[model samples]
Target: MESKAICLGFLPPRLGFSSPHLLSRSPGSSTFATRQKFDSRQTLLWNKPQLSRGRVVCSSSNSESKPETNHSSKSNYARAELFRGKSGSVSFNGLTHQLVEESKLVSAPFQEEKGSFLWVLAPVVLISSLILPQFFLSGAIEASFKNDTVAEIVTSFCFETVFYAGLAIFLSVTDRVQRPYLDFSSKRWGLITGLRGYLTSAFLTMGLKVVVPVFAVYMTWPALGIDALIAVLPFLVGCAVQRVFEARLERRGSSCWPIVPIVFEVYRLYQVTRAATFVQRLMFMMKDAATTAEITERGVALVGLVVTLQFLAVMCLWSFITFLMRLFPSRPVEMTSPLSELLNLDLSDTKKIIAEYIWIGGSGMDIRSKARTLPGPVSDPTKLPKWNYDGSSTDQAAGDDSEVILYPQAIFKDPFRKGNNILVMCDAYTPAGDPIPTNNRNKAVKIFDHPNVKAEEPWFGIEQEYTLLKKDVKWPLGWPLGGFPGPQGPYYCAVGADKAFGRDIVDAHYKACLYSGLSIGGANGEVMPGQWEFQISPTVGIGAGDQLWVARYILERITEICGVIVSFDPKPIQGDWNGAAAHTNFSTKSMRKDGGLDLIKEAIKKLEVKHKQHIAAYGEGNERRLTGKHETADINTFSWGVANRGASVRVGRDTEKEGKGYFEDRRPSSNMDPYLVTSMIAETTIL
Candidate 1:
């Protein structure tokens, strides 16, 4: 193969090199002294101007010097050699200097044309030569010629002809247009510079497509097909053309382009040779180890080249294609809605938005409050909407009703004929040892073995552990437990009820069974908290579960029989900097309105059924009532006891206040024995 290496040529500046229409020249007159004066004056004038605006200030104040020819025109001569000199400029005094330093003082605008022509043309030639042959041989050229050799010859001729023709036209146009601009004497060099850049680009491209690919293929082949050729051929040609241009540019004393192809060729050749050697060795290795087929040097080289070239081509093309796609407007699609379009932003942008949202802790309280406060489809009470009678409405109501009617110490089934459906709520309850301790151990047994305490150990062992363990494992990143403090553990209570009773109740039994308390780590699990649909189920109430029910029931039965004791409000529990909840943390008022333990709901039902006027619902929340004064006094006493006597006190200021509103205490009107109070106090041991 003929080595396409061509000489780096330097064309002397087109004649009339010192003319204004070409490279600018300093005008001169006939008189030598006048020329000297003019040169000195010109230098002084230019030297005074500020260089900040990119103007070169020529200092020429001291002018009683040597030859008169050493004027402005002569100065131009000295500097001109930097750009025009083919052998690179040197000082008249003979100091060799690179052209780049000269260019810094003589500023040149950004020019793409110098290398663009080659960049474009080289790629075209190589691409056509390598890939066009495939199409012609496979189908087109075969149809044109019966002889295989003729077809090959014709295919090569046609592609080469087209490539050369394109190259010639592009080069001719660029060369003609670019000269007029680089010749700065006319102040039109800007145009030439731009044209030169464009020309350079075109030539560079063509070179990459043609020269590089051809070189690679000749050196390594069999993998030179349409896809590989189209992909890698351009870059290869570009490399080759760049090499040729840079070599030529260096000869012309221009340092704008660098020699890159030599390095590329050397690297590629090394890879190909290494691959071949590896393959020969691999064959022997595989034979001894175990092999399906023999390995060949050619095959290995081809594979290595394909893998390397394929990767480079794909990466470059993919990056360019993506950039192009981003630059262009996206195509309009039949989108469902604006919201969908907003949600479906570019993947990177979407990720950024998500990161920002998480960092800011959701859309902020303003947005949340707006969303919470926004009234949905509000219906007039009198003008009952169709949904008011719909079965779905009943389904929705069925979920919540179970907690109110069945759970938390409500009416039970007839124990004689039908198994009494026991509902219990244990206070600070646990299975074995009391998690929340008391002074007298007897009180724990009394609470646990109470008459209405239904199934023994119902509010047993730690229930929160099961839920918490499952929660922590399921969402490792999201719900971690290491944040809480040991001093103040949040007491989570489960509300549970049983109903082996009438038809209406039994029908609701299926709904109640949904809270199976299955482990939540996997598929079989309780629905997560804050899910309104599941929590409000008829069988499952607010804070509903087996242990919670037993705890609450124990507290309630204790209150009814032994009188008011203590009260808790869990919701307003504020954590300190160390993350421990404050004492007297439980508050129903601060509980999440979404689905929290509704003490009023429990108190109302119990009092209403008991028909006791001492404890009446009167909060105006649908006329809900309670033994308000007595309950308050009991809670105050419990607080005082916790502070002073430590929860063991039975009566007095550290206990319940005997007043009119004290619902559990005997009324002044109703006479009661002192021994009765003492006996009830003695029964605390049963707990």
Candidate 2:
């Protein structure tokens, strides 16, 4: 895990991923001074608007000492409508709107292809595993081992091995392209990851298969009898009634219907028992005619095979079915860390605590922090005093006057430290109290604090997408060190080992974000194997910026502890891959009311006029990522459409149908500053 997912201070977009033959260096541990220089320098700080080659050019001179808000430009656009004409100011009343189809809305929940039922494949795998051990070795095992420990050992080994093999074959999809887990034709790392993840699960099931039967026989022998089994059959009739109720409950995020499947399973078990018993009875009748007991042993073995098939079926059926259900959306699978043991230790005895002061570094994207001792628990951020840091080391000031002041603005629970110890989100300023150039939050605050903006109560939902890379090779986790994965097809929101990677880290960060009290809405596997996304949403004004940045800090901390790099690169890979983005979903108070759809469209019109400005703040190297292909609009154009991933702004179909709801700005890149992106969207749409 020595790998780091470098986003802020990483090299300019590496060349290798875009093409097969293109060569590039993996900056695993390099001091990446190659971060996009223009990100920090070529900001949206235009001096004045000018015409350039039949287009408007609004840019600042390179020699400017301090940044200024584009007051006049913003003022003009604030009073403008969607469009203007010779007669009067115009609107989008007659425009043909782009709408997303209902069919397209249900994308790959497990990142599988359209109409491809992956759960069916898992059941097939379990069936095959059952057959190979029972039928393939039935005669030899019965003769050699006499149904003893040797036989059990042989059967279990074969079952587990074949189960792993079957899973490897069935789960072979990552980044939309199909390649079996064992497909070493391109990358041997496939075999490595398969053994590490799937094989572990295989062995786990092997133990469960052994333990479940023993436990059932010992603890519930009477429950396995005919009377108990028969009672379950009548309850199965209530399935329709249960479904009617469960569907209603589904809206409230509850489901009793999952138990209906369990009932069906019990009925299946009873049927399997009857079929096996009938076969054993037939064998006994035939064996009675012979003097030898050999036929009876074979009869018993045949019954065992049938019973084993049921057992294997149940094991595979439940696992894959649960996987499919979980793919629908569940709480992030928080990994149990030994570090959590420390969080549980009694701390009621002490009143002293630690408070970590965190702030944006000179790079703006990089986070820097230092801890201070506190007398006791404190909830208010204003009560926390400001601190100083060596600004020159972080590229924020000259060596002579290297100190930068930290103004504590927000506070979150300390997930790592536990107890009343906290993490303070701070912004940088000079000793004289003037904001530093890299203090993006200060600019965001000003916009959010505007009286017009405050009245609107702009709300934002930011979808932050990112890729996880191996620190050593500087390649995506689960990706081949120097080669490519199967082309993108089924990886969006995909589940299973072959389809998803780095889920443990993703889940860990999710929990940590929640523990730290950020408004993290959700998390999911993305359109690439090692890629992922989490959402910070329904947050109003400056709190949106505060929460998103803190959530990111939590993710970075989690990844650092796990020893993997979490990349925020918009396009970590190149070529046919899906690039990462932080799709900004936004709405003002007016946009959520009736006829809000028109207000949304009007906002888009303003966004269109200032598209270039927004793009500049989106993220560095976004031009390499936002090509017109691969579910992205061309970076140079601005377009709004309903439920379109390729549009600059996407109005979901539900929003159009209801004539109210938020619109998503899909143009923001994975590495875009949330403070800048969220605030700018509010400024344009409201102020």
Candidate 3:
């Protein structure tokens, strides 16, 4: 017999044989033998030439046993059959080789489809089971023993545990859901981080809920009955349980440990049930001791009472737990770059640093001092570092060797800072510690203490109005992007989402003023979309100026965060829109007493005489805002009338009716320096 070799090009490389092998069949035997090996390249030479009559002929067998003629069509079948055959020992060149079945080499473990029950239905069912039971049981206990202290405690504990446990289970089961991660590793603990984290946690945990109850309980423990305790207990227990679970989960090496808490929870539920039964029996006995008719009536009323208590308790507990989770949130691990560590270096320091100082001196504009570091807990306001600037820069001194010294007069808590920062309001001084001649603040102080002013007991309330402008466009900050909003209607003291803009900044400024110890009376949205007003009421003399300057400083700083520009221009926007103003309302002891309108009119008459002087001192750019087209009186003219917005001076109708009160000098522009305006008013009206 003769044999021929065939090479299959499409065979996978993993077949472990790259060379062609020999295949031979013995006479009268169904099996074939493959042996001998030759490089695949050699087979290519015979590839086109070996086939004759559509069949591959190896060698001649006996004449009676001819090679199959249809072998070409069955070539693929024959190759597949060869690979399917079981392994058998074969001898080739005195070496034994075992040919293994191809199927055995390619076998893999079967993967069964995961059930939806485990992934979705199981968690929902489990959470529902845990939460529903507690809710129902709590209602039952509260209904049966409304005034029982032990029952309250037990039910509270049970309800809180189940609710938190359900939350924990839900979180665990839904662990695959993606969550936002914070990278605190690169962030060193500092004021901003500390405050942000504290605020975030407080807001999450409904800090008011926890704090109000705790404070009320502490302050009026005797008055707060068992209800207070019941209300607080769930929040306390939920927080404790969540913390414990978190700690255990962190240290645990296996999943089995979580099951222990579950067992304890079951036991707690049983105890709650037993306590409820005991309280129910006691309540029934107490009811039985009363009249039969009263018992019947009470029984009928108890159902509604139980529902109301249950609903309130559940709402309170749920809200408490929800906020608690927010407070103590589970954060994801985050990756940060190496550069973040260097960037966040300032956060590592605990000491408060003086970042910037504000100087309000000769110039009407706010002069910002260069940022510098200062120690925390600055005990003495006098001890604060004095800043010096070129007096010429503020248009207060000749361009020579003269330098203006900023003498810190007062230190207010910096509301814009998350840490210990102080806002120092300063007066311009000379090297000799004498007040600078050009410092209006010092001038105002002198005028306030003058003998003529001291006897009048003059009080001032300044209504400061300003517009918020978008940084780049100069349009009203809250106005629509390109076009104007609805014309000057319905914006004053506006409520609702659509009508208001910049209320957040307004609110923030209001809070900042209050925190800075300024006598800020109130704030309201103004006539324009982005315009707002804040009032400083009844501040005497220079106190008004000092507080107003500080308040303006705070307002500017707050707007900086909003990326908006504050325009104190008398008419921030021209045309039909109303211009901004710091309308000064003033009253003396005589003006406040009986028959004060005549004194008010006398003051107004004097103001009319110096209208030009007051207008010049009111603010720069007063022409555009005081146009008679808007609500303001013309800049070149002066008039006074009762309850007249169009007049330069508006005496309130109440001032007219009561014959005593204050008159409003409505001519001052929004940008006017409060000190200069107040001093001028005091000098003209009182002094």
Give the number of the best model, judged by lDDT.
2
Of the two candidates 2 and 3, the one with more favorable lDDT, higher being better, is 2
The candidate, 1 or 3, that scores higher on lDDT is 3
- Over the stretch 1-687, how does candidate 2's per-residue lDDT look in tens digits? 211111211111111132221111121221221112122232222111110011111112232333323333211100111111011110111110111121111111122322143445545754575466657775676587864435544544454456445533333211112111101111111222233564566457546655544443343333233322222222232233334433433332221223333433443443345435544544555664765565555444445445554674577466445434433443222233435677677665777889999888766678788999888998999999889999999899999999999999999999988889899999999999999998889999999999999998999889988877654324577653223567776778888877898888898889988899998999999887789999996899899888888888888887776656778877776556788888989999999999999999999999999999999999887897789888899999898899898888899999999999999999988878889999889888887
lDDT of 3 at 380: 61
Report the Cα lDDT for residue 291, model 2.
50
Indicate the worst ten consecutive residues by lDDT in candidate 2. Answer: 77-86
Pitting candidate 2 against candidate 3, the one with the higher TM-score is: 2
Model 1: per-residue Cα lDDT over 462-563, one tens digit each: 111011111101111111111122231122121221111012222232223323222111111112211000111111111222222322223222322211
In candidate 1, stretches whose alpha carbon ends up further than 4 angstroms from where it belongs are 1-143, 147-157, 168-242, 253-309, 315-687
- The better-scoring model by TM-score among 1 and 3 is 3
Cα lDDT listed for each candidate: 0.25, 0.61, 0.59
Model 1, total clashes? 98
By TM-score, the candidates rank as 2, 3, 1
Tell me the spans in candidate 2 whose CA falls farther than 4 Å from its real position. 1-347
Superior candidate under TM-score, 1 versus 2: 2
